[model samples]
Target: MKSENNYERIVQNSKKFQHSQKNEMQKRITDLLQQLTNGIHERNQIMAVSLLGAIAGHNTFLFGPPGTAKSLISRRLAYAFENPQYFEYLMNRFSTPEEVFGPVSIKALKEDRYLRKIEGYLPTADFAFLDEIWKSSPAILNNLLTIINEHIFKNGDERFNVPLKALIAASNEIPPENQGLEALYDRFIIRLLVPPIEQEENFNRLLDSKPSSDKPEISEDLKISYQELAKWREQLHKVKLSTDTLLIIKYIREELAAQFDKLSVYVSDRRWQRAAVLLKASAFCNGRKETNHSDVILLKYCLWTTPENRETVEEIVMHVIKSCGFDTDIDLAELDREKESLDKEINKELYYSQDIYDTVEMGEKKYFPVLATFKDEYYANRDKKYQLFISFNKFHSQDTFNPIDEQGNTIDNIECQFDGQGSCSLKLRGNSYHNQYTPLTFKPKIIFHKGDKKLDVNKRLIYSLSQAVSDIRKQLIDILKQVEKKYEEYQQYLQSPFATQVDIDIAVSGILDQIDKLNLRIKDCERLGSLCR
Candidate 1:
């Protein structure tokens, strides 16, 4: 008894924790995001997502027309960290590497050595931003790829690990095709299209409001320190990818493959690996030990290569995530088949094998034949010989139906109505028998269950069916409870600074729909079990 009481207490405690769980990390992140995006119009998602990329230690690329506050976003992102070394530059075709990387060292050059001063330049910065990045020469772009990928800078013959955290690059257009920039372009995993203010109210608000500050005053407590970031990165590796997340990834990959001819989208394995890291970091920051479906939604911002395919890729990802709800190991199809089989077994054991309707055989066709009596005094002694048959579908219907003869031909001028009891009435009408047929009641032979031998129907069979139904119902109820718990946990995602409410709704709607289907199956099981009782 003590052990049982202890088990009950454990279960109760588990339920309590599930309901009251709060993600302190997510709340802090949300507060930081609000501070970062203060006074920004229609750019909250972009700012929040770019900050997420920075926290995840990944590069971000913003693509749009000029004057869309792309540079301002990167500048504000630097304030999220303590004493961030921020660097900004605008690139053009005529620009040289010295302007971006820093001027050459005069003393080193005098000694016949080639070295560039790396202070106050891209090499030493913790966060960097480049505007019109596509116009940069191959030399600058190539070096940037190394810094973004490996955080390494080569000055003269020595290699030093750069302190760069995340580089935010922006351009009005994509890099030219076949320009040897694909490798560098792929380094920036978080790609976003920074369109102009879309809504009229937002556009008006943008025109009416003052320009947002280049560096918002963030609280010191909210600003992440290098030590905290390093520790979080270490913890991020411990975050596991849930099975539902992996299934979502697999489905998206397969769908992209199937549509490759139409979509022309190809994601390299390296990019996928980086994307997984971003998801893990997301879950870690959101106070989750494992990546869930909400984190998987962030893949839409990571997988697309160009603005043209961005919407398509997002649709595909959303489709997969919405279709894959909480992964419960219950096979509803198999359960349905089990219920149907048991129902058939019960009917076979208890009900008659032959047709319930009284049928007469005529050339391999069986039908019910009835008679009609004349009501007219002129034809009172005359009884009409009419062949009558009830349709297979009319057993439960009250509608009048035409009678068919042994040859399966409709006997005109006669109508039959089944009362849904055991009896039916007929009406006759013809030139000779007009208004002359009395309604005749015919009782079809009743077919009952094997009443006398019901005891011999293997009590084990009925008991087994009942037990199966009970087990199925219990399993379904358990799965439903799990789904409810998952939903409750998902409520925490509403506070997420990265994912949108629309996407969360799509995922939750799909899960609820699946739960509804499971409930219907449970009802079917109950009905099936009743057949035996």
Candidate 2:
């Protein structure tokens, strides 16, 4: 009878949980965020994003030095759940599987059946935190990947479904180059930089405060059970995503892939799908039945692999978000490519030679074009030129018979001879003539001509180059206009009389700042266009 009553109680509570107002849910999350991030404004983004990722059922990785409240945030998050069953571990290179998954059951071993006692370990927890996570051994690392990715633990004969809602991991540094670590690294969808306090005032405040001893009193209204979180996740699929939201996602993905060749950054298709889910959950948690532009700001937390890449990815995503739909169709890559081709074509050089003529006395000393020909031996220089020379040659052949020792007695071997000789002098162009008997030497002088025309640059080529620059400038101007128009829209949305919502004022400023910077780039483009002309 008691068990039946308990079952009925659970049913009633679940119904109440499912029907809770969206505003109330957001309020609970916000309340938790405020308490968790109190007195630390710099790390508030990290805190808030961690909460959202956890609520969305994705793993979060905190990377920073040792003392920046990485474990504190996880503990705060674990405390937010009702009757939270938690697991926390500090891993090292020698850590074994038994330390994480719990020891093998001796009774089961005696029975020749293998099984583990996983009750108090990560496999049965509502939330878990692993510190220095990259230091784990392969034996522990492989099983860790399976549990995090599949949320299932295999214990001998049976597969046990892990009850974990969130897993928070921290590391002083990213894993060094190693094998078997990539799969574990890829399982964490959200990576955050948890830098220590940099501001003097914040640091002084930290010094004045006692190490946080008071847990935010978890009111019944603020507490979320694992079951309730599961139900809310089911509702995420029903959250409306507009066509524009999908279009923005597509554009961002393409841009990221394009930048990867130059930036050495890459994101897999699986991460992209998970990113969509996170955006949907962001909307669902913020009391909205549909996703809006604001929800996508969460993507800044989801896309980067390294801290340096984090800033770049945020810049790209914010640019897309800020454009508010006008940024599409502006393929800067293709435009830049066209610009390069024109630049190369305009600067290339060409060369040609003109023919020269010499006077040859035919009928009456008429001048005509001379086509040179060579007979016998001729030599040319490295530049393929044969120097002109003034020269003359004479040849003689003779045959004589002995004064006939009277009657045809043979003679002195028939007496035959041949001889040749020549006189020559160098001739220079445009010099006082030492004219030889020959009027011309049949050597045509070679001359070279060079200019822009040799490069094939004409009015048509210049006009095309200038036209391309104008087109690019026009494209940039169009994008700028859209950015300004979208900013105005965002302002009106924020100031609307019916607005009773979490204002996206920060995102608004971020987008406007991005637009302003884009306008500056447009000015640069204008200067570039003029130079191209």
Candidates in order, TM-scores: namely 0.75, 0.60
Residue 383 lDDT in candidate 2? 16
Cα lDDT computed for each candidate against the true fold: 0.81, 0.65
**Model 2 reaches what TM-score against the true structure?**
0.60
Model 2, 1-533: lDDT tens digits are: 54354345434433544344436657677777666666554766777777778778999999999988888888877767788888999999888888899899999999999898999998999899999998888888888888888889999989979988899999988776657586788778888889888999988888998786425566677777778888989998788875557767877788898999765667777887788888788777766776666777667777887766788888787777655533445765576576566545444422233222232333333322322222212223211122221111111212221211223232242221222221112122221233112112332333333321343446676677667667766886787777677655443222211111222443444455556556665675565555445
- Runs in model 2 deviating more than 4 A are 1-22, 39-41, 324-533
Best-fitting candidate, measured by lDDT? 1
Candidate 1 — which residues are off by over 4 angstroms?
A: 1-23, 336-467
Candidate 2 overall Cα lDDT vs. reference? 0.65
